[model samples]
Target: MAEHPAYPVGLRLTGRRVVVLGGGQVAQRRLPALIAAGADVLLVSPEATPSVEAMADAGEITWARRRYADGDLADAWYALIATSDPEANAAASAEAERHRVWCVRSDDADAATAWTPATGHSEGVTIAVLTTHAKGRDPRHTAAVRDAVVEGLRDGTLVAPHHRTRTPGVALVGGGPGDPDLITVRGRRLLAEADVVIADRLGPRDLLAELPPHVEVIDAAKIPYGRYMAQEAINNALIEHAKQGKSVVRLKGGDPYVFGRGMEELQALAEAGIPCTVVPGVSSSVSVPGAAGIPVTHRGVAHEFTVVSGHVAPDDERSLVDWPALARLTGTLVILMGVDKIGKIAETLVAHGKSPDTPVALVQEGTTAAQRRVDATLATVAEAVRTHEVRPPAVIVVGEVVTVGPREPE
Candidate 1:
C-alpha cells in the first residue's frame, strides 16, 4: 500500500543536509528558500547555472559537479530532486530512500516521502501551498502551479484559505509584512482566538506578544539558520494542535500564499480532515513597493509592471529582466532584489535602450517609521546608494514615474 501523502501539519528544515539533484532554474528558485529555511544544501548538477553557481561561490551551498550517486545520500537528512531530467531524479530518489533520508522529488510528487510546498513568509507568518496530487505531477508542473499561486500573491488577490463552509471554529489570519502593526483588525481578532499558533520566525514579535503568555507557539524554522524544524514537523504540529480541539492560526506573513507556501499547508490541513480559514493581508510584493510610495503601475507613468524576486530564479547568461521590453515600454519598472544588483540592473537597462539619464528612486524601509528616499537618474542611483549606504528591503523604481518628483535643490 502507498503511503497517504497529506500536508504535514507544519514544516522545518533547519540544519538538515539536503541534496538538490539538479541545478536548473527550479533548483535555482528553490535553493535559496531551502537555505533560508536553514538547510545545508548540497547541489548536485553536471554544470552550474548562474543562480546555482553564485550560491556555490558564495559558500551558501556545496556544489558537486557530478551525477547523483548513492554515496551522496549517505548522511543527508532530507533530499529534494529538482533535476531537469526526470529519469535521473527517479534514480536519485531510490538512492535517497536507501540511505534512509526523508526526501521529496521536485518533479514527481509521489516519488518521495513529501512534496515541497510553495511558501510565503513575512512579519509573523509562513504559509505553504501544495497540491493534493503533488506526488502525481512533474516538478516543473508542480512549480508552475506554485508559480500561479506566486502570481496571485504578487497581484494581492490570493487570500488565506477559508473553509468556513465546513469548519465553524477555524479562523484565517494575516500576520502582516515584516512589521506587526501592519496586521489587519480581523487578523488580530482571529489570532487572539488561536490556541495553537503554528508560526515561522518571520511572524512579528509584537503580534506574538498579543497571544496569552501560555498559548502554545510552534516555531517551524525548517532550516539551520536558527531553530531546527522540518516541513513535516510543521505539518504535524498543525494537525496535532488542531486535532486537540485547539484553534490554530497558521500565522504567515504577506498574505500567506504570496511565496509563503501557504496553499500546501491549507491543503494538508484539509486533507488531514482539519477545519480552516484564511484571512488576507498586504503582501510585501506590492505593499513593499507601495509602502515605499512607488506604484507598480501608474495611469500613464506605468502601464504594465512585473514584480519578481531579486534573489530567486535569477537570469541565465544574461539577466532574467527583459531589458529591451522594459526599456522600450512606457511604464514603471519596480525591481525588488535589484538593490544589490542595482548597478548591474541600471547598466543592463542603459545598454538595452533606456537612457542613462532615466530618473530612478531607491526607497528604503517604505511605509515604516524609518523610511529613506534617494532619487537620481539611472546614471547616478548606483553611486547614490553607495554614498548613502542603502540596504536590502529597499526597492528600485524606474521610468518617468520617478522623474515626476520635484527637482533637487541646486
Candidate 2:
C-alpha cells in the first residue's frame, strides 16, 4: 500500500497545548520553535539537560518531573515523542493517536502523523523545507537546501518582498570590525540594495567583492586628497547621488558614533536636504578586546573603561585630551588610532603619576584573520609597540583588566 503523503500547514498554536515527551537534545531543538509559536508547552521527562532545566526554571515552559503517563496527551493539540527509550516514545505516540492529537516521532517518522521540516528565516520571511517524497526521509538534503536558501538571503542573492523596496536616500551603515559575518543583517540587506557605496578602508572588505557590478564603490580613504572633492567631495557625492534618486550607502567600520565621523556626514546630508538613515554597527573598542580574550571590565579588577582617540599627540597644541585626568583614572583605558602616538601617550600617562608597571595590551586588526595580541606595561608598551610594528587601526588597552577574565579562546 502506498503511504499517505503528509500535508503541509502552519499551525497557529498561540496559547494552546503542545506536549513534548522528552527533555534531551531533540526536545531542546524543537521546544524553541514551539515556544516561539506561543505554544503552552508541557515537557515530560525523568531527567533533562541543564538548558532544558534552566528554561523550566525561567518559567518559559512547564516541566513534568515524572515519566509520561497514558493520559498525558489527552488535551494536547500536538505532541512530539523524542524520548531515548523506544517503548516510552511508542507509548506516548499511541496515547496521542487515541486522543486524535497530531504526533511527531523523532525515532520513527514512518509511524508518526507529522514530520518536522528544516527551517530558516530572513527579513520577516520563514522558510521550511521538507523532502516528503524522498525515500527514507533524509533530513540532510532538506537541511542543505535550507542552508543554501538562507545564505542567498543573507548575501543578497535572494531578496524578500519586504527588502525589495529600495528607496532613494543615504544609509550610514557601520560594517563592524573587519569580519564580513559580523555585519548586521539590516546592514547587509541595505548594502545589496545600494546603487552607490562610499566605503571606509576598515569596513568589511570581503562583502565588497560580492556586490553587484552595477553598484559603484568609492573608497573613502582614496578620495582625492587636497582636491575640492576630498571631505567636501565625499559629502557632495552623497548629496548628488541621493538627489539623482539613487540609494547610497556610506559603509563604515565599527559603530558610526564611535569616532567614525558619522555625524559629520549626517549633518552634511541634512543641510543639503538629503534624507539619511543610520544603522549602528558593533564597536571595536569592546568587541576587539573581547576577541583577543581580554575583558574591558572585571568585577574586582575594573568597573569602567574609557575609549579615547589618540590621533593627536598629547603635547600637540590642538590636542584636547586632559592627560592628567586620564592618568588618574583607576579603570581601563582604550585608545584608538593611537599606534603612532603611543610612545608619547605612554610617557604622558607615566609623567602624570600613572604607574609605569600598569598592565597593557595591544590588539592589531582585531576580530579578523590578521588578529595579533601583544602585552606590556605602561613603561614597556612603547618599546613593545615599536618591536611588534603595531600599525594603526589597532586597539590599545591599559589597566589591570587586561589580565582579568578569560585568557584563552574557547
Candidate 3:
C-alpha cells in the first residue's frame, strides 16, 4: 500500500515542555517562534550563537549548556532537532520517538514525523503554507505561493470577505515620504476601513489606488499653484462627511503634525464634536535628507538641526521666521517649500552674517524614484536653482553638515 499523508494540526504548545536541539542558525531561527507560542523551550547545546545567548540572558528561553541527553525528551510535548551533526539530530529524534513526541528534523525532513511550514502575518491574520515533505516534494514552490498571498493581502488586492464596521470618526494618517510600503501597519489598516480618504499630494498615491471602489478619495492639495483648496473648505468637508456617519482618513505625506496643518483639522473636528485620532508618519524632514546620503546631524559636526518653512520670503512682512536668529545659529538648517523663494532666503541669510560659501543641498522629490539633489553654496544656490529650474516641494539644507556625507556628483 502507498504511504499515508501525515496529519496536519496547530499545536497549542502554550506553557508546555518543548525540547530544541542544537545552538546554530537553524535553532536560532526556530527558537523565537516557539517562545512566541508560549512554549517552555529547553535549548540543549554546548555553545550558542550570540543572538541565542542574548535571548537566554534576557530570560526569554532556558539554555541547557550541554549536549542533548536521553531524558531531555522524557516529558516533552514536541522536539525540534536542528543540530549540525546528523548523528546528534538522529539521536534526539530517536529519544523523541520513544516518548511519543512528534519531531521536526532540519537535516533530514523525510526522517522526521512533522514539518514546519512557511508562515506570515498581516492585519491580525496568520498565514501558514505547508508542502508534503515526502522525497519528491519541493519547499520553494510552496514558499513562493505563500509570499504571493501575503503580498496581495498587504497591498489590499487579495481581501477577505467581511463587513467593516463604519464608525463615523476622523483619523489623521501620515503617509511616509512617498513610498506605499512605508505607511505604518495601523495607518494602512485604518485606511482600509475608511469611507472617505482626504489625500494630499505627498502621501503615498499608489495606496489610494488599492482602496475598494466605494472609498471616496478627495484631493486635499489646494495651494495656489497646486490643485488648490482652502483650509476652511477642507475642514468643512471633513466635518460634513463625518456628520453623515462616514469614517474619514486625512492622509498627508511625512508626518501629520510636522508642518502638515494636522492640528488645524483636528481642532476643527473637535469643535464639530467628532472623534478623531492621529497616526504619526515618518517625517521627510529627516528621512528625505538621509535618503540622499545627507545626515542632518553628525557627531562632532552638527549638534542640532532646525526645520523651518520657507513658504514666505524672509523679507515678507507676513513672514514669522526670525531670519537674523537663524543666520546666527551654528548648526544645520533645513527649509521646506522654499524652492520658489530660495534666492531671497539665501540672500537674507548671507546678509545676516551667514557665510556666502556655506554649503547647501537641495533635494527634490525626496525619498521617491524621481529624487535628485542639487549641491551649491549659499552665494551660488540662487543661480543653480534657475539653471536647474528647481520647483516647490524640495528640501534645502544649509550649514557645514551639507558637506559632511558622501561626495556629491558634479
Tell me, by TM-score, which candidate is best. Answer: 3
> Which lDDT tens digits does candidate 2 get at residues 1-410?
11556677889999999999989999889888998999999999998999899989999999999898889999999999998889888888888888999999999877787889899998677889986653467799889999999887876767553445556899999999888998887899889888999999999999999888899999987777575856687888889989998999999999888999899899999999989999999899999999998899989888998999999999999988898899999999999999999989999999999999999899999999989888889999989988878887899999998887555441
Clashes of 3: 2
The global Cα lDDT (0 to 1) of model 3 is 0.87
Give the candidates in order of lDDT, highest first.
2, 3, 1
Instruction: Name every residue pair that clashes in candidate 2.
Output: 229-233
lDDT of each: 0.70, 0.89, 0.87
TM-score of 2: 0.75
- Give the range where candidate 2 is weakest over 10 consecutive residues by summed lDDT: 157-166
C-alpha displacement of 63 in model 2, angstroms? 7.3
TM-scores for all candidates? 0.49, 0.75, 0.84
Those runs of model 1 whose alpha carbons end farther than 4 Å from true positions after fitting are 1-172, 178-181, 200-204, 219-236, 316-324, 405-410
Per-residue CA lDDT of model 3 for 337-381, tens digit only, reads: 899899999999999999999999999888787888999999999
Deviation of model 1 at 341, angstroms: 3.5
Tell me the tens digit of each residue's lDDT in model 1 across 1-410: 14354655564779878888888877888888888888888888898789789999999999999877768888888887887777788777888778778787766665677667666653345556565654354545556766666544433335453445424334446676567777775677566655777776655556676577667776767422335246656666777777777787887766777656677778878898887788887776666666655666767666776655455323445545566666676667777756877786777678778899888887766556666778888899889989989997676777776655453332
Ranking by TM-score: 3, 2, 1
Model 3, runs deviating above 4 Å: 1-3, 164-168, 179-193, 221-229, 243-245, 267-277, 290-293, 297-303, 315-320, 367-375, 383-388, 401-410
- Report backbone clashes per prediction: 62, 1, 2
